[model samples]
Target: MQKRQSKHKGKSALAEKLCPVCQRAFSWRKKWQRDWQNVIYCSKRCAKNKITKEPKPCE
Candidate 1:
């Protein structure tokens, strides 16, 4: 009997994205497959920091 072939023969290339807050390169993940387009920050910490670090308008 012949061995079955896999749908993915080799390692799939992981897409990379830059984090807005940390400014670091991050790779794609299975959990973010559906919402990859919406992902901007690398982690929750960065996301939270982004909200607090926003520049305030002069009064």
Candidate 2:
């Protein structure tokens, strides 16, 4: 018997985006399929610790 082809492609073929909070490259995920455009953080931790204000310069 032949193996069935999956609807989804390989990981390398998936799209990628940089996480604003961690500045790391993240690939598309099944959970974010519908809302991939709105994803900004790599993980929940980064989302919670997102930068809210610019860092103050040392005097």
Query: Where does candidate 2 have its weakest 10-residue lDDT segment?
Result: 6-15
lDDT of 2 at 20: 83
| TM-score of every candidate relative to the true structure | 0.68, 0.70
Tens-place lDDT per residue, model 1, 1-59, is 99998676343467888888888999888899999999999999998888566688999
* Model 2 regions more than 4 Å off: 1-8, 53-59
Cα deviation at 2, candidate 1, in Å, is: 8.7
lDDT of 2 by residue, 1-59 (tens): 99999987789998899988889999999899999999989899999999878888899
CA shift of 5, model 1, Å:
6.6
Q: List the residue pairs that clash in candidate 2.
A: none
Off-target runs (Cα >4 Å) in candidate 1 are 1-12, 51-54
Clashing pairs in 1: none
For every candidate structure, what is the RMSD over all alpha carbons to the true structure, in angstroms?
A: 3.2, 3.6
TM-score of 2: 0.70
